[model samples]
Target: MMPQSFETFNNIVNSSPVLTDRFSALVQDTISAAREQHGVDLTIEDCTAIAELRNATLGATLDRDELDRQMLELSSLSDSKLKADIAAGDQEAMAVALQKVNAGKEVVHYERSSDDRARRISMARELGIATPPPVQDDLRSRAEKIELLQEVKNPAQRVALARKWGLL
Candidate 1:
């Protein structure tokens, strides 16, 4: 159950156009479901709780366009810094360049993962599922794979494992 008061819920919903739209679309259905399944007419508070649950269960709403815009800006900034560092032609600059490259890769990977999660959540909602899809496999991040590679004494075996994981 939502612990928030009706006024708090109203404030929240009013602050976000997305939430307002979602609440508007969901309220009637929520009320009907409560009446049919629970044999109780929902109060305004009850309806808000149901809407909040549905929203929360799916995941936070993301503005993909805004996220993409920010990512592009960050990538541009990183690339400029990396190029300048490489152009300096010093050992420290070279190390900084490598770090920048790794950081950029990490950011891109994170963005892609967030996109995948949002896609899965959207798909689940479309299929009328009440819960987000279960993760089916344990996947290691690139950094974890790199750390694991350091433990492998055989260089050839390390390369093979890296290739298998698409880290090469």
Candidate 2:
């Protein structure tokens, strides 16, 4: 099954979205700790029930201003996740939100095929790596053929472009 939403993570009502890297160990530890402290073994589900009871007494009885502040914090964190095509205003919010995510993450790139041979040769030269000259085709270059076909209108020109660009 899919994981629970992050908004309900460790919630008093549900505990399905455990974000720990070692979830089984965390669950076992919670159960073990509860047994050690209370002299009764408590499963993860039982621990969740206790949390609900704790919220019933503690959260329900908070002072008005404190409750309002706490509710504001909870609402920000527990609101629904963003959609793919967020509204324009939300997109701006997401851009700011992204600034807080994955800063300085490393990225790796792999080499491409010889079709980019000309680009690679220039790059190697700039990096001071000795490189052999590129093997040039006797006929018109690929870019030239593509550029030549841009204004093509006649049916025969399409066939000519196809054959020249080897799309046939």
- What lDDT tens digits, residue by residue, belong to model 2 across residues 47-109? 333332234332344243543333323322212122121323365545533432322223312
- Tell me the lDDT of candidate 1: 0.55
**Considering summed lDDT, which 10 consecutive residues are worst modelled in model 1?**
67-76
C-alpha root-mean-square deviation, each candidate: 19.2, 18.6
Per-residue accuracy of model 1 over 78-104 as CA lDDT, tens digit each: 344444444454557556544433343
Cα lDDT, all candidates: 0.55, 0.42
What alpha-carbon RMSD in Å does predicted model 2 have with respect to the real structure? 18.6
lDDT of 2: 0.42
**Largest TM-score belongs to which candidate?**
1
* Residue 141 in model 1: lDDT: 82
